[model samples]
Target: MDDLNLGKKLQMYRTSRSMSIRELSDATGITASMLSQIEHEQVNPSINSLNNIAKALGVPLYCFFQEEIIKEPVVRHDSRKTIGRPENAEEVYYELLTPDTNGTIEFCMMVIPPHSNSFDSVHCHTGEEVAYFLGDGDHIGITIEGRTLHLKRDDSVRIAPFSNHVWHNDTDQTARVIFAITPPSF
Candidate 1:
């Protein structure tokens, strides 16, 4: 994410809703002091924290990083917007393949590190998603609802809305995957 503008956008969104930092903290389960730091750009927030904040604010997570709507048809790889939390143990990187989140579908590439998982707990979003595993060699594990599924190169899985799921890379090699989601939840 753009650290320079993240704080400004967050502050604008929070104040526009007439909600205080404490109120946002209560709604997002984040500490008020930490939220203040995030608003002031003193520290970077984890992906989970940002997701919670976005959900609580009723806004998409990409809004903080997206500067403007793209009028062009093509999005260059170098110009893609990215957001990640390096502080987390499972440091996954995501790059937007689409210009912005305003489109009907959100497309992005995820890079999962070796022996890493996407989140600390089960994750669920309002939008339905399809994740396609890319590259060769190692297989990735995805647990949706209560079933575990292994995906190899070229394998894909469709995730229903609000289904608890997590992505795992158990192999020593890094795994790459692409995700397409409707309604652009993340």
Candidate 2:
């Protein structure tokens, strides 16, 4: 996300509500300077900070991310209609907004087109997981609790379910990585 661009969106929302930085600060208990930084996109906000602002602005926290999606009454982004995509293209399929589930955690879908590489070369997180999936030969490779649980299409496995686990599909076909991340890995 463009940090600088965020300021404009924040400013728009604030002004539309006829709320100044000081007013927002009083309402949200946030410093006006911090609010100004956020409005200018100079600072990336923490979850608590975002929630405070969302409350003050009378919007959902997810409104800041899915600008276009929030405009629709229903979630309309479809995966099947994604054009020019290969048989197993690596693409983010969906973004789930669950306020009841602490809202900080996010779940996104990734389709790894056959014989393709991950957009995240390698990454790390902080929790655990109970993992399972299926695909083609050597299709699923997940690092779970220090063990590399590998599975092929239709094969299933269980993991401890932690954020430290990593998933990779190094095959000629696409594999889906179903995830549950804490503290929201958006």
Candidate 3:
């Protein structure tokens, strides 16, 4: 399972959520030294412990194993739905697929300009999100997810939250996307 890489992933997600070791300690009741050790691969976290960290981070415990995550690019346009155009650097946009504010899942489209940031607010609630990005050469990172998900054209990712998540563009071009979430968040 590549303990070192998994530890790094866990650390990344934890820090991305703006969570400090002490804060995580408070939330998950783990120690700062232990969390630090886990990050450095000095100690292996048990599955139950990993699950606790995952729960505290608001992410699935299994996301640490996703490999072969490819990158994609953009070229054309189609109406899958949620065609929202948030002003930013990526020149990109997206559509939401569900009622995140009404039920359990909030769906929306995201259009990001290159080097743009995707977000509405540091909103919080129950459930999680899975974003299928359609922007090629667009760099998208959800802080709550820890690592950045770079897409080529059809890359997708799922995110849970331990803190407020922000989507950022790393490329200096336009990007587009579709975001879906469980549990309503308006």
| lDDT, candidate 3, 48-143, per-residue tens | 456567779988644553334212222223523222223322334444343112333456666666666654333333567777777655456655
Q: Between the candidate structures 1 and 2, which one is better when assessed by lDDT?
A: 1
Query: TM-score per candidate, in order?
Result: 0.86, 0.42, 0.42
lDDT of each: 0.83, 0.54, 0.59
Score candidate 3 by lDDT: 0.59
- Best prediction by lDDT: 1
Stretches of candidate 1 exceeding 4 Å from the true structure: 86-90
Against the true structure, candidate 2 reaches a TM-score of 0.42
Each candidate: RMSD? 2.4, 10.3, 16.5
Q: List the residue pairs that clash in candidate 1.
A: none
Q: Output the worst ten-in-a-row residue range by lDDT, candidate 2.
A: 79-88
**Candidate 3, run of 10 with poorest lDDT:** 67-76
Q: Model 2 over residues 1-186: C-alpha lDDT tens digits?
A: 352255677788899999888999999898999989978767656544665677689875545654332333343445222211233234423234232223445544445555543433334443332334635345677665556767766765544433345566667666765555555433
What is the C-alpha lDDT profile of model 1 across 1-186, one tens digit per residue?
A: 653377788899999999999999999999999999988888778777888898888887877766464668698877766777645546887878987777778999988889888877888888999999995447999999979999989999999999999998889887889999997877
lDDT of 2: 0.54
